[model samples]
Target: MNLNIFIITSYSFFDQDLEKLFLCNLKYQDFSKNFKNYENYSKLSSNYKLDKSKHWITNVTHLFKFSREFKNFIKRYTNYYLLNCLIFVSIEFLPEKIASVVLGFISFQTFVDKFGTVFSIILVTILQMSNYHYTVLILTTFYGSWNLSEDLLIPYFNKIHFTMSEQNQWLNTRKGVLFGIGLVYYIMMQKFPLISFIIYSNAFFNMGFLITKITNEIPDNSKSLGTWSITESVWDGHDKFLGESLTS
Candidate 1:
């Protein structure tokens, strides 16, 4: 078990993803320091566009209800949370070392990769039906932590013009490290859900810095793990809707 834990831990930290987490923390600290300067503080305040006269709760509610980005975050968070839970449950039946290896490999796959998603979902459903409530709960919290960590680097990925497929492939090929970096941010977001948006603002710069470092180290030679018809269909539908929305 100790060896298993060490293997998992080593794999997760192999690419120094934890360094990216630290980088984000340092960036957040620098951002907080800017609040001490009136000009810098005012500049920062202008970006949020929150009305002072409104109740804080009302403003937050509005942000949750109407912010597209927030909605997308919620969607991604929920999906990944569930997916990770299933993955954790699936691996639990295996021996420690084998489980660790399986976990690492699956984590490297894209959420929608081929039949993996369907298989995981089916397995999770079977387990849930078997009444493993306590086990599922624990795994959900464990796997969900670093699941959405990639969201922080959206700005960098966008700047580099990486499509969803490309992004997944790239991350999949260089897995473990990004998961480690995301774990810290995930804990922070859980502890301070309301302030996540603010944290994300600072995270953008950190992502840019981290991505530059990552790209320099890892050459982008990630090949596709085959196409998922469902994913492609969804993307196509989304593009069609976007086109119509723009035209109208």
Candidate 2:
């Protein structure tokens, strides 16, 4: 969209503090090592330079620098999105009784867009495996609460990590927990066909997005291409579901 709008949203969401863009222009090593006195640092001001490279076009391909990860990400996510579109069509065609059950998939899509596809997928799978209507109801409320919690907690976590010397230890611990959780979901997916389909589809979406994140350095755009892609997908899904009602 508009550059100014993108910057404002990114500043609000991605850059919680004003420091990120400032730090991007600075050499972290220089600050860590050469901070003897204010005078010395002030004198060395001319040494730092901003990177002014061209950004990627947010298309399927880049001319000079080919990102294999980006390519694979596109391929995987396109397949997943198309499969979800098919599921939507099938849901639309079903009888009212069956459609009511399948209608839950629309809620799943909404959750996926909000909390992230992978996390939402795992959560829905867990709800399905629980086989309790009350449990599902509880989790639906929990998800809304959890989203609010993240907006407060994430900044605090980022501050803590920034200050702590044992940040790597905390990172490792978080990774271990995530891995364990993912493994549990994997096992759950094996038992349930619906869960399996959702888990795989969401996994594809998440994987592609993650790969794009890892390869973000290749793109010189200050705005996140991955964020744009997700927004585009969400709109596309919305249009597909609403059909001509979206226009009205």
For candidate 2, write residues 150-212 as lDDT tens digits.
222222232222223232333332332234334444444445645454543343234322222
Q: Please provide, for model 1 over 1-248, each residue's C-alpha lDDT reduced to its tens digit, 9 standing for 90 to 100.
A: 11222222222222335434544544455456432212222222111234648776776576466443334455666665567555566666766556554444443353335347777566544544454444344344445544445555432332233455665666664455466666666566556767764554454445544443344222222232123212321222335434654797
Where does model 2 exceed 4 Å of error? 1-65, 96-248
- Could you tell me which 10 consecutive residues in candidate 1 have the lowest summed lDDT? 38-47
For model 1, the stretches where C-alpha displacement exceeds 4 angstroms are 1-134, 217-248
* Poorest stretch of ten by lDDT in candidate 2: 211-220
**Highest TM-score scorer:** 1
TM-score of 2: 0.25
| Per-model root-mean-square deviation over C-alphas | 16.1, 18.9
Best model per lDDT: 1
